[model samples]
Target: MKYVALFLIFLAAPALAQDDPAVAARAAAKALEQASEQLDDADSARDRVKALTTTVRAYEDGLSAMREGLRRVSLREMDLRADLAEREAEISDLLGALMTIGNSEAPVLALHPSGPTGTARAGMLLADVTPALATRATALKEDLKEVSDLRQLQQEAEQRLTEGLQGVQLARTELSQAIDSRTDLPRRFIEDPVRTAILIAGTDTLNDFAAGLGEITQDEEPGSLPAISDRKGYLELPVPGKILRGAGEEDAAGVERPGIVVGTRPRALVTTPTAATIRYVGPLLDYGLVTILEPQADLLFVLAGLDQVYGRIGQVLPAGSPVGLMGGEMPAADEGLSQSGEGGGAQWTETLYMEVREGDDPVDPLTWFSTDKG
Candidate 1:
């Protein structure tokens, strides 16, 4: 559905080009406002939870759209800069030729000519060159104006990118706080201190940790949580963005993984796709700040690359419950590759690494989530 909406938007570009940017920004702001209103108007805890989810997702979508716009503007700025350079060179050459003509010995020729016919010929040549010089001057003036406009556009694009990034950060902070406030759900799984300690002590690899976690029995009643098997091909994405990598694909390190990587806005909300028990939440190996969730007795989902985690080990959370958030701003680099950012920068890219397993066997998550790439 998200892809369809975007495709429709693209198709209407010719009609929307004049006002699309302002309209899109306004629409995003309006969506956020409406979500907030809904949250306030909600009469029940369930309604409020839904409202909060909408609010977070709206903010994520808004930020994503703004970033995309800024990227397009950046590309346009690069093209404009190239054009400006070429135009400047042309203007410089034209000016040089004009200067050479202006400093010519035509005046001396007028005073001392070989004959009347020679003088008439020189006069005709001067008349012909005058219009050409005027034309070149006019072109030079237009090129100067164009260069100035390009500079202004570039400056505007940079300003928009900075503002968009700041807005995303603020929205993310608000979403995090809202998620933290919802603590009304009953605990379905109690933390096993002994098991947790043993798992932490004995496990050195992800597989080993997962195996240890699988051994721990859940205190929650069976059939209490929703069955993920029943919702195949209709699950919402844990985050609101496009999928970057499909299952069985090789990552930057050239290791083939049984999961999908999603490219999301910086500090985007990361939530549970279904009700699940938290098995682990911490940094592990190259996967920073990972969160492991078990949707069923045998099914496990792994989410990695979080800047901050929310739930604790053995806690049962409802579907769409906040797990954590994507990392904050990072240095600008190739977004396609998964590289951790050094510090918060004006523009950054984040990748959410996700994996699914059923009874220790890896499964393709693309077959589970809705096909909508919104």
Candidate 2:
């Protein structure tokens, strides 16, 4: 009967040992799955900051879940440790009881129960309990071994969760930078003279022209030009006289002219257009202080023989802004005109030259205009 009881206790030990480690591992895996789902949802919607934040939160939650699992594992280990300790103490007590039960003096003492041998009676009970004590001690030692294995598992899970949190932080930083890059440029161009005519030309031709201008691409993409119904295209000066000269011309060469010589600036020549970006504020050659109105419609219109240059690079002006003072020293306005004749005069002519390059090939500006009479 004693041996049978000991055999049953040993049978129960293996079952208890199998349950704890399996339960902890399952709980940790479930927490990780939930965290992964949240990260995926944030990424799909294009909100990088939100996605990174979600990942961080998920990692935090995972850490909490892992810690909880560790806590449960630790508790389970403690329970096993306590059980082992209790069983050890119980085995010692049982051995004393079993020895007393199996003692040879036990049967002889039964006839003299009134004698002063109570301690001796207990000795026989300890002898009968001895085999049960040995079986319990071995079972409890196996339980202690399980607690050690569980402690190692908890440590490994903690280390992985720490690494996951760091990865989340790095992702958040990059997403913020990407968002700033997309929104940094101006929402609209503010009354820019150089870009306004380009916009009027329509989308396709403007894009083609802008592609050829390697330096201009750095600023902004050229937009479509607005359509004008009249097709007056650009206004031309009706009166023939020396108006302005461009930079490189036969007469203006080395003469320190402000603008390219097309015609000499007549003393009473009216202000037709404004200077664009004032590249050179001071007077140059036969031309007075010349300011190159940043080109419009692929035409670099020079306002030569100017007493003043009124605008800066980003400044916008209405038509006929005063650009320069009239003087004979300035280049003639009609110096380069094909129909007009060039003559020796302090009065210079200014003719508009259109260099319409598809890429590098210059096309005649005369063909692009609506009216040839200008």
Best model number under lDDT: 1
RMSD of each: 11.6, 32.0
Q: Please report how far candidate 1 places residue 313 from its true position, in Å.
A: 2.7
Which segments of model 1 are wrong by more than 4 Å? 1-50, 69-171, 178-181, 214-224, 330-348, 372-374
Q: Estimate candidate 1's alpha-carbon lDDT, on a 0 to 1 scale.
A: 0.64
Q: Tell me, by TM-score, which candidate is best.
A: 1
Question: 252-337 in candidate 2: lDDT tens per residue?
Answer: 34443222223423322223332223222334333345444332433334444443333333333334433333443321211221
**What's model 1's TM-score?**
0.60
Q: State each model's CA lDDT, in order.
A: 0.64, 0.42
Model 2, position 345, has a per-residue lDDT of: 38
Q: Which 10 consecutive residues of model 2 have the lowest summed lDDT?
A: 331-340
The reply for model 2, stretches above 4 Å from the true place, is 1-26, 29-47, 91-142, 171-374
Tens digits of per-residue lDDT for model 1 on 135-194? 657754764564465456545544443544454455456556665676766665666777
